[model samples]
Target chain A: MQGSQFRLEHGKKVRLANMDPNETGSLHDREEAEPNIERLKERLEALQNMLYAEKKQSVLFVIQGMDCSGKDGVVKRALGGLHPQGFQVHSFRTPTEEEEAHDFLWRAHRIVPAKGMIGAFIRSYYEDVLITRTHKWISEAEVKKRLKHINRFEKLLESSGVKIVKIFLHISKDFQLAKLRNRLTDETKRWKFDKNDLVERESWSAYEEAYEDVFKQCSTESAPWYVVPANHRWYRDLAVLQIAVDALESMRLAYPASDPELDQLLEQLQE
Target chain B: MQGSQFRLEHGKKVRLANMDPNETGSLHDREEAEPNIERLKERLEALQNMLYAEKKQSVLFVIQGMDCSGKDGVVKRALGGLHPQGFQVHSFRTPTEEEEAHDFLWRAHRIVPAKGMIGAFIRSYYEDVLITRTHKWISEAEVKKRLKHINRFEKLLESSGVKIVKIFLHISKDFQLAKLRNRLTDETKRWKFDKNDLVERESWSAYEEAYEDVFKQCSTESAPWYVVPANHRWYRDLAVLQIAVDALESMRLAYPASDPELDQLLEQLQE
Candidate 1:
C-alpha cells in the first residue's frame, strides 16, 4: 500500500466499498478474523517506544468510509495498543460560522500532530471533496481547488516530518443495511443511528463516485490511501494493524540510551 | 468526593489517584514500578464490555495541573486498558483566530463525546481559569465569567449524560523543579523541556492561587476536582486508576441484556 505508482486493479463495482477483488473466503472463514495477539503486542510496544525515542517524526491516520463500514471499529483496534498520551483522534463536523470564514483545511491544519505524536482524523478534510461533491455543498471549482489544496497540505505535513497513513474502509451495501437494521433493532444502539446516515445511504452511488475521485486525486506519494475490505470486522482490524505496524517498523526506532547507558541507569534505579 | 456537602478535607495532602484512600502505604513506599497487570487487564476488559454495552453515557476525563505535574503520565496510565476506538484524547492549544472569535467553550462543545464513548481533555476549559488568569490573557472580569461558565458547562454535561472526571495532579514546586532539571540534563529528554515551561514555572504561585480560587468556586456537587499528590509516579498512576474505576463503578451501568425474549432469536442465528 506504500510508495508511488502502485497499480491496484480497477473493479467494475461503482461502490468503493464493494470494489474489493478478493473472493476466496466467506466473512466467517478462519483466515478472516485470525490475529496473532502476542506478536502484535510486541510489535506495537516496540514501535511505540521508537516513536517516543525518535521523538521527531509523527504519524497521522486518516479514516474515511461509508456508515458501518467499520471505520470506528478499525480505529479502536488498530491503535488500541499505543499509549493514549502519544496519540489523538479528531473527528470533523460541519463548519461553524467562524470556520466558514477561513479555508476548509484551517481547522485541520491547526490540529496536525507535532513532532513525535500520532494524530488520527476520523472524517477529515476529505469531507470537503466527498460531502461537497456529492451534495453540491460547494462549487465544483471549489472542489477541484480543495483536491489540490489537500495534496499540498499533505506534502507539507510530510516535509515537516509527519507520516500520513490514510485508510478507506470498504464494505458492501448489504453489510451496511444489516448494521443499520441492528442499530434500529437494538434499543441501546438506536441513538447512534442518525437520520442523516439513512439519508446518506440513499445517495450511496453518488458518494462512491465522489470517494473514487477523491482517492485518485488526493492520494499523494507523501501520504497514500489503503482501501481495506471491511465487510468483516476482524479483517478490517487486521489490515489497519498491519498498516500501522508496517509504517512504524519501517522507521526502525529504538529506546533512547540513558546517560552512561541504560544498563548503568537500570542498575542504579534498581538499587 | 461524593454526596451533598462535598466534605473531602481541604488540606493534609490528598491523592485522587489513590483508588481506595483507606488502603494504606504511600506510592513512594513501593519498591518496584511494575503495575498489577493481571488485575488491570481484568478490570479493563470488564470496563470495555460495559462501555460497549451501555453505549450511551460517555466518559470524559479532564486533566489540569502545573507543568511537570504528571498530567500526561496520569492520563496514559488510567486509559491503558480499553480499546482506543471507543476512546479519544484531545489536547487543546491556543484558539485560532476563528476559535477566539466565538465564546470560549465553542471549540470544546463541538468535541464532547457522543453517547457511548470516552474522551480526555488534557488541558480543558479549566485553562480559561488557570493559564488565562495567571497570564492575564483575559481580563479579571472575564476570568470570573469563565469560572461560572465552567460550572454551568460541567453541570450541563452531567445532565446530558456525559460523565466528567476532573483530575488536578498536584505536585510541589520543588518536585517539578527536579523533574524539569532531569529533562534539561538528559539529551533524549531535552526536547521535552520547553522554554515556556520555565516561564510558566516562575508564575507557579500565581497559577496555584488561580487554581485554588477556581477549585473553590467551580468544584460543584456534580463535577468535583480530584487533587492528586503526584510527586511519585507509581502513586500517581494508582490514584488515577482508582478514580477512573470509582467513576465507572458508581455509574450504575450494566451490560446489555441478551434477554430471554431475544434468546430464541439469538439461538436461531447460532444454529
Candidate 2:
C-alpha cells in the first residue's frame, strides 16, 4: 500500500501505483533523476521501425493523473519519435450529449488501436468511474457495475493481444494547489483554468479515494498500473518512458525481415 | 488548360484544377518532388520545437481524392513527423443520424482545430458538395447551398488565421481501374476492394463532373484548391508535403521563449 511496495521488479525499476490513499511518496527524487537520453532515443527509433514492420500487438497506454501533474508533458516526451502512422494518442474529454447517452465506455472503445498500433489514452475511461463516483453522478451500485465493466473491457482487450500499460501521475495536493494558483495568474494558461477544475480540486480527497478503490478492483496482472511520481517533471517523464519501453520490450517485436525489394528501397532512399 | 500551364509565376501556383482536371502535373517538378530526406528530418525536428513553443496555431488540412487515389497513404506519410499533442487527424465518414440532422458543415466544424493546433480532415465539409453531387444524396440546389456555406466557412477560417489548404489527389480513371483489378487479384488488397467502390467506379465520369463543378464553385483565393498528380505515390507524397510545409512556414511561428531557467534545465539534461 505504501510507496516502497509500489516499486516495480522489472530490471527497469518500473513501479505500480500505491493502493493506500494516505501514503506519501517523495516526488522530489524525480528532480535528481537523470534521463538516459542517448540510450532512450536510440531505443525509441528502433521501436518505431519494429512497430512499423511487425504491424501486430497493439499497445494501449492509459495516463491518469492529477491536474497539472505533468501528464501531458510526459506523454509528449515519451512518444516523440514514434511514427504517426503506427500510433495515435486519443485525449478524452467530458463526453458529449451523444457519448453520454451510450455506455460510459463506448467512446473509449472506439479509440483502442488496431493490431500493430500504439495508442495513448489521456484522462481515459477511468475518468468515468472516478469522476462520476467523486461527483455522485451515478448510484453506488451503478458505479460498481461500471467498474466491473471496466475490468471485463480490459480483459477483452488483453485477450485480443492488446497490451495495456496504465500510469497514474502522482503528485501532492500542495503541488496541485500551487499549479491551480499559477494558472490563474499566467496569461497563456488562464483560459485553460476552468472553474470546474477548482471545484474538482476541492473534492481532492474524495477523488483520491475513488481512484484507490478503482485501482484495487481493476488492476489485474494482464493490464497493470504504474504510478509515476509527477512533482518533478524530469522523473515523471523518465518513469513513463521506462515503463512504456519495458512494456514494448516484453512484446519482443522485431523489425520486419527485409525483402530484396526492401533493400532496394533503402538503397534508393540513400541515392 | 494543358499540363504545360500548371506553372507558378510567383510562389503561388495557378489553380489549374478548374481549367483541365485531366491535365495533372508531373510530381517531379514540385518543390518537394524529391523530398530531401535528411533535410525533411531536420525540418521535422525544428517543427516539433515550434509546435510545442507556439502551441497556438491549430491547423486543419482537408484532403479530397478519388477512389484508390491515395488519400490514406498521403495522410500517413505527410503527418509522420508531427507530434499528436499539437496535431490530430479526423477522417469523416458517412453522416450518422445526429450528423445528418445538423447543417452539412456542422460535424466538420465541431472537429476544427482549437486555436494553435493542427487537424487533418481526410474528407470534410466539401463532401456535401462533392459526394452529394456525385451520388445525388441531396438535390443539386442543396449542394449549391452547401458549397456556398463551405466557401464562407473557409473564408471565416482564413480570417481567423487558419491556413486552409484543400488538396484533390488527381488520378486518371484508367489508373483507378487498373488498381481496382490489382486489388481484386491480390489477396492482401482484395479486402479493400469493396462492392461500393466497384459500383462507384461505374460512375467515374459522374464523379469527375461533380468534382469539376465543385472546383468551379468553391475554389477561392483565400482557400485555394490544389490538384496533385497521384498516379505515383512518391510524387503524391512530395506534393502533399510541399503544401503542408508551405502552410506551416507561412505562419512564421517563433519558438516560445520560456523563462531563462529553461536553458538551465537543458544544461542539467546535458550534465
Query: lDDT per model, in order?
Result: 0.71, 0.68
lDDT of each residue in A1-271, candidate 2, tens digit only: 1222443332232223343322334443433444454466567656655664577678998988878776666766767656555567877887999998998889989889888788888899999888888989998999889988998999899888798888888888777877766655554554445556656888888877887776677767767767666776666666666777777788888654434443343343334
Give the best candidate by TM-score. 1
The Cα error of candidate 2 at residue A183, in Å, is 17
TM-score of chain B of each: 0.85, 0.81
Candidate 1: residue A120 lDDT (0-100): 85
lDDT of 1 by residue, A1-271 (tens): 2222122222322345446623223445535346453356557766775686667788899998988877666666666667787777777888888888998889999989887788888889898899888988788898889888888888888888888888888877777877876866676565455657867988889998988887777666557777777776666665677777777776656555554543343344334
A-chain TM-score in candidate 1?
0.86
Over 4 Å off in model 1, which ranges? Answer: A1-38, A136-142, A251-271, B1-7, B10-73, B82-221, B225-242, B248-271
Task: Give one digit per residue, the lDDT tens place, for model 1 in B8-72.
Answer: 33323333333332232433353443455335545755675577567768888888888888776
DockQ of 1: 0.20
